[model samples]
Target: MMIHRLGTMLLLIGIGALPAQSQVAPLAPSDITNIPPDPALKNWSVRTVQIPMRDGVKLNTIVILPRGIKNAPIIFARTPYGAEKALTGAPSNDFRLALPTSYADLAAAGYIVVVQDVRGRYGSEGDYIINRPLVGPLNDTKVDHSTDAYDSIDWMVKNIAETNGKVGTIGVSYGGLTTLYSIVNPHPALRAAVPINPLVDGWMGDDWFHNGAYRQSFLDWVYRMSADKSSKYALQFDRQDVYESWLKAGSVSDMAKQLGVDTMPMFRKLVDHPAYDEFWQLQALDKRLGKEPLKVPTLHVHSLWDQEDIYGAPAAYAAMEPKDRGNDENYMIIGPWRHGQGMVADGSKLGAITFNGNSASWYRQKVLIPFFDRNLKGSADPGIAPVTAFETGANEWRRYDRWPMSCASGCPSRSKPIYLSSGGGLGWTSPTGAGGFSEYVSDPARPVTYRQRPILGTYNPLTTWGQWLVDDQRFAEARPDVVTFVSEVLTDEVRLAGQPIAKFFASTSGTDSDWVVKLIDVYPAEYAEAPEMGGYELAISMDILRGRYRESFSKPAPIPANQVLPYEIKLPNVSHRFLKGHRIMVQIQSSWFPLYDRNPQKFVPNIFTAQKSDYQKATQRIWTSARYPSRIELPVMP
Candidate 1:
């Protein structure tokens, strides 16, 4: 009876009428297939091809040619992300808009842009290994990123119709890693390389881990990358607050299992090897690239507030500097950017902090473009210095003959110790009193969140991952588990141009612990300029060190319970000025929350596999005295 009533209703509505069928008729072949070309893309020619590697694997490559191009040099980029999307996703008559924003100046300068998908990603063929190690001890396979890069360059120079055979490699993050790999056994046509925020060492400081503390947030990325060749999938969460999600997920291993990423090779390796083992050491790009003399003119771009891969640019530059005997081939650009923002966005401001001008645009037009023209196009001198750094507080750029003249090997920079004293004070002089310590109770159950609560996923559109480095530190300073040591208002500006070393005469009641040190710039309480920034605590440089690996990064051992020990934490490089009327601050804590996996406090063989019971509250102490003066050695610029 219900079926009969439904049929009568359909007949009354004329659901299958002849006129309705005509209205829903399929589009004509010409109407569907022959669409007018975008007027905006009229000046650009875009095409894709499968370029074969030495191993017979075909990588999907996109070649973009500018209008009326002739004898043009090639700007090449290899990436795991989709080449088609990166190179030609947006169709525009303006060549600058046709490519990534970072390459805008180069795009206007008229060069053949080539982008390709690395093996086993996107449209490329072959198994994808995250940061595939070079063909050496760690990887017995002949096909690696370096080899693939060599083959790709060889193919491009030989097959492309462009007259000029010169090629320059440039990319950021993973793509930046590929750019570095290209210079390993560079192709004859390869002239220049720009590795911006490249992934150099995973276990030491880059992605995955920083000084043995795992960045568990990267698990979502791993799951997405390894799930399939396409970028369609994303890790979903039942809760919007990632801090809560991670806290409730228990151990890193448990998180992996719950996400069902435990079976992935990358996740398994991360879980299996929590320490800096041979697996990681052998894959370090700096160690590998530094072994040979510099073959290509390379420019290393480092972001001052690079939330990810902060240690890579300087580390790689330091390793390769000695090889550049003439000092003309190796160059470094340090910008006030978060990750790849230097190339991708207007660098006028970050968060609430504003640079006087568009720093990124200036860098691209004045520095990056000229660098490429000199090496790739055989242009005259661009007058680029060995080090081009953006001074944060000063809101300007400075040229230096060499970088970190105060801290690097055989450099002239002096290391001035700023002692952490009692009463939450920081001073240039050593403490004269007897041994005294500042104490805090570190509980794993309530690990301090790296940022304010309701932290989003690493790659989430609304995630603070990019700007968190420059985020105000007042949130962390307000916590009880976190200890703050602030200096008196400066009478004169204090400039720092190199790495800051934190010397902690510290101890933990438990057998294991973690130490997080932050160097901050405290603004004045009352200010006319940017009133909202009043009393802001801006972190200049910060890093974490797992206590087990304090003695040796490769080895892990438990701390002596309740015993005083000296741990040296090397903070990332910085170029900043503590303006007069401002204060210098240092905040030390045991946990950076789900950002870095919580230290069990109770020593376990492997933190990844540790049980919930392994986590406990421990009394952590920081000693200050003439004999054991806990201080941060700042590379104060003369």
Candidate 2:
């Protein structure tokens, strides 16, 4: 969703994107498809204004109001992307409101809809800071996104006409981050907020780095939103095959030079700090949330398979839920969606897999509409559940008073462990003897492709890279470098409702390495209901751990060659059901490129600065002996 070379497609910008929290949001089907403008919009007036901040910088804002409506509650959205065209430009006047779409419904329901460009973005005055850090304990002169939101809301309520003296904020991706920031220092009139797929932590998850593993996708993203806010592809390459160009460009640092990144401040700053240093830590919104949760009621929505920003929503909800227990104000909804797919009407499918119903439409109508109506417009409570999520294999939606419904009180959910045997078998029994392990040679020059084909730019609408998380894992199933462990066909359903922990007894032939663990659900070969579902290898949850950072992210030390070590890789929490006759699988590999930048098997002070010679082929081992058993711990559901 980040502005790309195609010249800032307003609907596409931040539709499904993030940053170091700035990764680009992806476009939903509705974004590209055209619908005719609604005749009802003719009754509404469009006004553009330069709203001033405390520091005197002005933001470009657009207000759309129904002429006959008065005392309407204000529905506000702040975005880093341009607001003018998206708010007014359109074929289907209904599409004007952008993702959380249903503009016609909101307008007909009587509300003052407003959209504004965040300071430093298009038509706004000020320097832009990507994922601007939330300034804690700031003086009146100190400014941050939190202050910007506060200032804007303060001005709107005081000057804007025909208001019910109430305000609500909502956005997806970066705008979601802004929504999160808005409530960090909320305005008096701000009644409710919904932050969809917001980037909660840039260092551990979400946009740039994940547990010290730098995502190359960040580079592709930052390039699209350069200092001058132009297209990265236009500035760098005219060629379509981006993968070949990236490979030819060589190392991570070298790619910067090829992109002519001398003027791209964000890229420079990012490469300079490759670790989870203070720079990334400061931008993390979850850490900034602190012990005392925000007082404002919030509904945090996210997709289970969101290519970007997957870690933010649940993390933010968990952090706040404990403090706001029984308040019925903190809520979360996770679906089988890609980034920003929650806003699309047809959310039943992602690539080859399909859910039974239109999940997105149900959410918008049954949840979002009622949530705002009650909180912002003083209507009856919708009585929504605290957690509403979709179960993948089951193809159904479930609600809970709390997420991951604990089994302590005889709930259906349970936790089970599946061990890796000496052979390729996955079973409940642990290995008996000593010195049993599986080894594979990982060649840096021949790294496994993150996807089946060439890697594309992050914003390429033509590519399936955006939904690669849910892509068929069979692409890498036969690769020699990947070690596979398979479980027998299950007799009953096995539902995983929480985080799955990977306890790996691993070693490398060199000083440094990377461990990528994938928890997969393999369909039987004779699957009949859906032919494409037959032999499907779907990755339920997966994560990587940089061997050097196994000890500390700040001080990445090398591993002793051939000495086995225990590594704990906590995959993102998943909601899935492995049905009867299906087999569970675990794939262990050394590299997943260029989804994650290649890790030099040899120890280096910094991977970003490593020379070509630093990259080496190493034989990685996964031990399953009784002395050091490796297994996957699943939060099973009853």
Q: What is the C-alpha RMSD of each candidate to the true structure, in Å?
A: 5.4, 13.9
Lowest summed lDDT across 10 adjacent residues in model 2 is found at 91-100
Put down candidate 2 lDDT per residue, 1-638, tens digits, no spaces: 34464556654676645345566567765756567556566666768999999889998888877767788888788887667645544533343343235554566677787888887888889877787776643222378888888888888888787888898898889989999888886899999989999988877888887887878757766766664542324344546666566555557777767777645777777677777777776666776665656678899997988888888998888878777756588888878899888876578788888888888888888888788899888898888877887889998877777777653244766668899976899998877788488889999888887778766666666778657888789888799999999999999888888889999899899999989999999999989988868989999888788888898776788899999899998898898999998999999998888778788899988887678888899998899989988999998877
State which candidate has the highest lDDT: 1
Q: Of the candidates shown, which would achieve the greatest TM-score relative to the real structure?
A: 1
Number of clashing pairs, model 2? 22
Ten residues in a row with the worst lDDT in model 1?
405-414
What are the Cα lDDT values of the candidates? 0.88, 0.80
* Model 1 residue 92 lDDT score: 67
